[model samples]
Target: MYCFTDPWYLPVDLKLIKSIFQKDFSYFNDHGMYCHPKDNISMNLFNLVNEDWKNLRAKLTPLFSSSKLKSMFQIFVDKAEVLEEVIGSYSSRNEPLNIEDVASRFTIDVITSCGFGIETNALKNSNKEFMKCGVETFNPRLLKFVLMEVVPSGILANLGFKANGAHTNNLFNNLISEVIQYRETNKVFRNDFLQLLLELKQNQEMTDDQIIAQCFGFFAAGFETTSITVMFAMLELALNQEIQNKLRDKIEEVLEKYDGNVCYDAVMEMNYLDKVLNETLRKYPPGPIIPRNCTKTYRVPETDVIIEKGTRVIIPIWGLHRDPEFYPDPEQFNPENFNAENKANRPDMAFIPFGEGPRMCIGLRFGLLETKLALIKLLKNFKYTLNGRTKVPIEIDPEAIFTLKIKEDVWLDVTKI
Candidate 1:
């Protein structure tokens, strides 16, 4: 497929997709997204290419390790508690809850506290500065998005254009600068992502700009993806009452083993919860398309097709996820699709909601944990049903460029169980 003058290839075969993503990764390692050299914020891990990406990925991988995520579990729990209170207020009045909005607030609070080491309290106060920044960052502007994609970063930089707006960049810069200075000066250290970046800085492994960029990346990546996942999962559960009740029962059953606490170990024990989330991801993958740039000329295996250097490749994840060949009754919301027996029947690469290979999202564990914790809190305490305001057969927002989002608000009538 060619979009304008750019040649793009959409590989539908699982083996070829695997080769592109994993076996022959060196041939297509970059996302080919625009990143202006002058835009320091754009130089974060998600945008950095080749060697820079390798170095930054190596430095940041450990920060999301299981042990590190476990240490940060309490932050998720605290924010979820606040979420419960907020949702409780709506449920008490029998009001239709705009769940997407609430979910976004919950994730904003969790990400800011864990990633930036600041308590924005977005869950309680919707007008928090961090909340505003998050909304602005993701609210897609068609012109800016198209410009960033088609125009070369250098040309855009020469034209004095930034990928992100000046306001967003400045807010993150000033906030990060103040936090770093205060922490270093006062010898205040906390067990958070920012603290880990500071340690890297102390060891000369990362620069201050690198630290800020990575933190901004953390917020940008973690905030919306996880929140939308929660929103969609809740919407699906609301639509399917039996599955919702079964999942809630399983959640309660698992918590009893650990004296009714949503601890790291307890969350880990909820296998059914994992299946539900996996199915949710399959139906509504946050990142529906995987884009790659051919870094080296390569030949298709057992074929004469030659992939030229600088060509773009697109993996249609949404198509693959919903393909009836891989998943029977593809549109049905069935957690059984992720059951061990069912999973064994499909290709490993067929269900990549968080992507696959080395370039897979680094915040996979962090995002999953926060989402699961929120579900556990919400499901165990309340029951939800699709409100009349929520249109059936939800429509995807055409303006959403990066992540999967619906045009209508996901409104649900909540009831205290």
Candidate 2:
């Protein structure tokens, strides 16, 4: 079948998937997740389409460049330390550590530190107000999720509907606005993403709501993507002890060069960590499906199949990531699958944990750096094993069909080494 009877269309051929992402770029600029002007909180990069997306994304892109990442590396290093101290307590209690919970805490602080100039210390203080808002932001409402993802956003906006509640939206708006204002008034400058966004505001083209949307957008995309990636990576490590030990050994050797500091330089040098993260993303990609709206009529290259404009395309990233033909023994959690020689042996598009194309996640670089740094700190200081509370042979939450969300806590017994 060239198309499905449902509202979505599937590009059955892998080449068509690439075509949608990169080859026929003009035809599919939007990811199809919608936003409305009525809900300023709903107006984020992930939901934007066409010109609005292009304009806003252009302003934010340069800030995430390589040089900029280097300037912000220390903030991530500090959070890694907090992760160690926080998780250490769980080890001392001899309690089964819920990695899903702990990992969320780590990413929350990362978002606060990176998005705002101040550290909310979410990992250290669980009851911080920002923590509550952060949770409310990510744990999206069921109806809102359907409306934002399934229904046309213009219709919802026309009917006076929004993706987030006013109370929750106000909290984020007030928090980010206050932080930026305080920074400007006090001449408090920080080498972080927030500073970059603040600088963009000087252009006179960026508005407070746009800035707020971007800050919240970082959390929306970064929070679950980074945290869940870590959770799945840890879960895999717990089940595959041999692979875990090998990675730990590599971490120890590298940290010694940095005097045991989990610095950007040190983490980047750890080739094994990259392999491990690559493998985890392969088995359980953060965004399982790449959703895109066909903005113009297009025909598949070398085929007569025509996809009409305004059609929604679902790129089955999860299916492609696990295709046995591309990845031999696709079910196993093996880091060697990402080994230099092995990776080169496979097609480049086959391993797109981050969606392929101009609209692909730019924050993926920061996500990878943060995740690898977290693993570096954890593995170097402690050891983990599967706890009784965890379900064996893991499964994703049905509700989290778009993103990989485990139904149960990926509880692990942590032992300080």
Candidate 3:
């Protein structure tokens, strides 16, 4: 077991993360993301490192650029409004709602609109198959897949370990493959993530397996993390009414400046909204720990200790974000931590939600815009408060593989402001 199980797995502060990512990147260039190149369906950008990663990244980068995301903002706005309407209807019934489920559908709608270029109406139909597929794929047991990534197969025998999960494997493979075929045959040109992959399939010599793998990557990367982020953001907003009021004030101010429309440019102008989102991400990073592998033997700069080839390097982002040195009173939800003055005083790597370097998350712009647009519409339409049923200091769902989620139902009451 290469994983550091001896400790409680805490104390991964930002400075240590900077050493692994920026200060000592040459020693830890590759993330030990899951890959089974032989399986074809198992390959994606997340699993690729070095030149292969470089090539795929180049291809996908233009797709998520600022202009591209701006072009797609309408999709986010439409889906977010749908989410607003859906949640509003529920509030009219005076029913305590599980925002976990609502947030899942909201993200799924965004994914379908921006990823597949198809409307999922997940906010409209909670039982959509796409949402179900996402639930299965991100199941906490998927960590077993990650185990195969960092540890050698021989070591597995000693641990009684197997990497694959049947449910997630089957669900992702089928869902992605079907989406690709449907797009290709229909000659759809909506210019979303899947459509881009389809164009590659037609224009490039990339195999069906590669196409499907990229689609799978889109699904995995796009859906769960953003959904969980919205969930946490809403949860925080519900608990902190003063913060919510401040955020709502900012949203209304921005919209009023743009002629009562929450346009792409208006979302861009939301400085405080951006701060709240950044603070939420800081307190509850989607993937709190980042894992990398030492591709070659290297010695620590200050110490004589030599890290062998294939050494597993873990950067605890969550621990670092909460470190008192970088972010004083890290436990408190303070948007001021991200204000221009305080932000300029902080270290470069203290805030790494989307990561840094050439391998940074490609979908970051799109992800943030989608999240912001949702919050804008949601807060503008309704005021949220933590319902009595919701547990304080909510427990993180143990079953989520790549993101933090509420294990139990998180209910919030909404009243139109």
The sequence of per-residue lDDT tens digits that candidate 2 reaches over residues 1-417 is 233244678765777788788979899988776677777877888888888998888888897898888888988888898899988998999888888778888988887787776676778776456556545655676766765665677788888775656556777789888987898899888877788887888878788888888887887788878988999999999999999999999988998999987777888899999999999999999888888888999887887878788788888888998999888899998888988788889876898889888889989889999998889878887999999888887767777645777777888999998
Candidate 2 local Cα displacement, residue 296, angstroms: 0.4
* Pairwise lDDT winner, candidates 2 and 3: 2
In the range 313-354, model 1's lDDT, one tens digit per residue, is 998999999999999899999999989899999987899887
Best by lDDT: 1
RMSD in Å for candidate 3, one decimal?
3.4
Better of 1 and 2 by lDDT: 1
**Model 1: per-residue Cα lDDT at residue 313:** 95
lDDT of 1 at 30: 92
* lDDT, candidate 3, 96-208, per-residue tens: 77887888888877876777666667788775677656755566364565566447655654554323344545655676677777766886678677767777777874666
Candidate 3's TM-score reads 0.89
Of candidate 2, the 10-residue stretch with the lowest lDDT total is 1-10
Q: What is the clash count for each candidate, in the order shown?
A: 0, 0, 3
Report how far residue 408 has shifted in candidate 1, in Å. Answer: 0.8
RMSD values for the candidates in order, in angstroms, are: 1.2, 2.2, 3.4
lDDT of all the models against the reference?
A: 0.89, 0.82, 0.76
Top candidate (TM-score): 1
Deviation (Å) of 312 in candidate 2: 0.8
